[model samples]
Target: MRVLLVGAGGREHALAWKIAQSPLCEHLWIVPGNPGTATLGTNVDLAADDAAGIVGLATREQIDLVVVGPEAPLVEGLGEVCEAVDLAMFGPSSEAAQLEGSKAFAKMIMLEAGVPTAAAHTFDDPAAAIAFVEADQQAWVVKADGLAAGKGVIVPDDGNVAATISAIHELAATNAGTRLVLEEKLTGPEVSLLALCDGERAIPLIAAQDHKRIGDNDTGGNTGGMGSYAPAPILPYAEAQALVDVIFTPVLRTMAARQIPYRGVLYAGLMLTPNGVKVIEFNARFGDPETQALLPLLKSDLLELLHKVATSNLADVTIEWHDGAAVCVVLSAAGYPAKPRTGDVITGLDRLPSDVLSFQAGTATNAQGQLVTAGGRVLGITAVAPTLREARDKAYAATELVEFAGKYQRSDIAARGLAE
Candidate 1:
């Protein structure tokens, strides 16, 4: 089968790598992929959001399946465009994608579907939002209703009501046509549960934990994702399946009842609170660094799994995973998550151990034909082993080999999983 995977990030590179390994994959193509993906398949020069270009390419190339790696294109209705052309695309439609596009919409769905989540209130007026924060005098998680590239939510310091109000004003002034969803702060270790949906039933994958903060020990602000580890000991596969019955099943039933069947990956950002497991947010597609970590442990054919989801035949497929752990450490450029410096030559590609996998994200070819940093998060170094400790050690060791000017990474990744 010919496959055309969308997006140009580390997640896309991971998907491309997995797809290329499938015996059924007769041909593979990536739209505007980075250097890492280029080594796996034919890298098309068209942008991922160019709906018309993607449709034309799929038609011309006779691509059997189109897998989207990011949420932006799906939120922009790329899946709808593919459907109009009678193309099989592995992403939810725009209406179904509202689960990620609009936080307010997701909150409403959770409330209506009897899904467990934090107490929240949506406010369109900045003054009203500020008044609410001031009256509560409690720390709140302020989130922009619309998409903000995984940096939309701001978790204020405990008892910092002033910071909460300030965040409200900042978001109100900057996010146009967007409201604010202020949620009561929930405490616990977070887990990511992503499942393949067939518009009727859902199959849960191994759970993962993502470190969102740029600095170590969970300091600093959130970027896309700094690092991640798979099969987070906190939520094993059996527990993850039980979560599916409670979290994913209700949401899927709600979506189907509303005549908007959800297809593709349904990612649940969960907080294992003392009270119980509560959802933090939902992502329509796969998580970034989490994908880099999880894909290496998957023993099943990725192309077949994705094709089944796209065609509503997921019920016939049973997923399988390796009996080990995986970890991903992200390498960032100078001053990442605020203002990242780019165009620095990278080295140590050839020095990575054969067991380690390097997935590129923000990279480009310079005039001298040298690979250089072109975005904040540069690359994801991943490794798998019999234990989380070994995987973490291998991944961090690989990070030392790769060098770029002002390169930054957290000293501690997968530490929580190791402790668990």
Candidate 2:
């Protein structure tokens, strides 16, 4: 089977790596893929959002399946376009993708599905939002209604309603739409659980925990993802299955009832609080650093699994995972999550051990033909081992081998998992 994977990020690189390993995959291609993905397959020059260009390539190449890695294209109706051509694409339709595209829509669905989540209120008027925050007199998470990468939501520090108000103003002024959703801040260790769906059935993947903050010890602002560890100790396989029954099942059933059945990956950002497991957010596609870590531990044929999901036959195949654990540490450029500095020459990748995998995100080839940083979150260094401690240590050791100007990383990645 010939497959065309979309997007240019560490997630796409990991997907390319896993897909290339499948014996069923006859050929592989990535659109606007990074320098790392080039080693795994042919990197096409077309943009991921160019629906017409992607369709033309798929038709011309007679691609067997289309696997999307990012959420932007999925939210832009790429899956619908693929359906128009009878092309098998693994992703949710535009309507179903509202689960990620619009926070207000997700909140509404959660409310209707009886899924446990934070109490929230949507406001279109900034004044009304500020009034609500002031009246509540408690810490609130201010989120932009539309997509803002992974940094859309802002959590005020320690019940500082002033900060919350400022965040509301900031999001209202900067975001394209002034709409906002203010949610009651819930405290707990977060978990990332992804499920593969076929518009009817859902299969849960290994649970992962992502470090969203840019600084160590959960300080500083949020980023796309700093690092992650798979099979989170908090939620084992049996526990994760129970979470699926409580979270993914109702959500999928609700989506199907809406006549926009969800296909592809349904990523639930969960908060394991004292009250219970509550959802933090929903992503239409795979998580970045989480994918970098989780895919390395998957023992099943990724191509077959994705094809089954795209063709609405997910129940035909069973999922399998390695007993070992995996960890990913992201190397970010200077001033990341604000104003990242790029164009710095990178070196020392060839010195890494064969056991470690380096999936590139923000990278490019300069005139000197040297790899350089091109985005905030640069490379994801992943390592798999028999234990989470070993995996975390191995991943951090690999991080020391790579060198680039203004390169930084969280020193305490997977610390919570190790504590568990």
Candidate 3:
């Protein structure tokens, strides 16, 4: 099949690499794709946000399948557009995407479906939101109702809800975010659980833990994701299954009953509290740094799994995961989650380990035709091994092969596993 993947991020790069390994994927292409995809297939000169441009390319290219990588396009109804043209697409329709597109909407759905989740309130006006936050004594979570590239949610430990309101205003000033969802922050370790919702069934993927903070100890502003590892040692297998059966299944069934068939990956970022697993947030697409880690541990043919979901027979298919552990460490440009300098010369990428794969997130070729860092969270060095320790070590070893001016990474990618 000829597949067209959208977006230019680390997640997309990992997907491209996986697709290349599948016998089902005869041809592949990417639109507004990154420098990494250029080596695999044709990279069309169109932005991921340009819905019309994507449709035009699909029509011209006669794309057999369209896999959306980022949430922005999915929230904008990329899948719906493809459906109109009879194009087999992977990702949720805009209506189904509301689970991730609007935080308030997701909370309401979970409430209606009796799914385990945090209590949340929605407010359109800034003043009202601030007032609620000021009076709330518990730790709080503030979120923009719409998408902000995984950086819209704020978990405040001191209950400073006003900062969330202020941040929304600041983002709105720059044409970013509005209507807010204020949630009572649940206490516990966070886990990113992703599964394929094939309109009627939930096909589980590997469980992962994403390190959102830019610094080593998880301190510092969130920037998509810095690093991640699969089969989180902390959240054991039995505990993860309970969350899926008690939480994810109920939510997917509710969507089916509502007549909005969810047909893509549903990433439920959960807080495993003493009480139970509570939803932190919902993501319409695959997690970036998490994807980098999970893909390497996927033993099954990805194309076959995706095809089953798109065709909607996921009830019978079993998605298999490798017994080994996988880890991914992100290399970032200086000053991430804020203003970042780009176009720095990168080196040593050619020496990447045979067992490890380096995925380019935001990268470009310089005038001299060398791949250069073009985004804050640039390259994802992913590797797999029998144990989490081996995976972490392999990822770090691969990280050493890559370099550029102002390049920095966490010395500890899977440090959380050490707590055990």
Please, what is the whole-model Cα lDDT of each candidate in the order they appear? Answer: 0.93, 0.93, 0.83
lDDT of 1 at 150: 88
Over 160-213, each residue of candidate 1 has an lDDT whose tens digit, in order, gives 999998888878876532699999899999999999999988999999999999
Tell me, what's the RMSD of every candidate? 1.0, 1.0, 1.8
Task: Locate the minimum summed-lDDT window of 10 residues in model 1.
Answer: 169-178
Per-residue lDDT, model 3, residue 201, is 78
The positional error of residue 254 in candidate 2, measured at the CA in angstroms, is 0.8
Q: Model 2: per-residue lDDT, tens digit, 203-315?
A: 89989999999889999988999999998999998888777778888999999998989999999999999999999899999998899999999999999999999989976
In model 2, state the lDDT of residue 143.
Answer: 93
Question: Residue 26 in candidate 1 has what lDDT?
Answer: 98
Give the poorly placed runs of model 2, Cα more than 4 Å off: none
Candidate 2 shows a clash count of 0
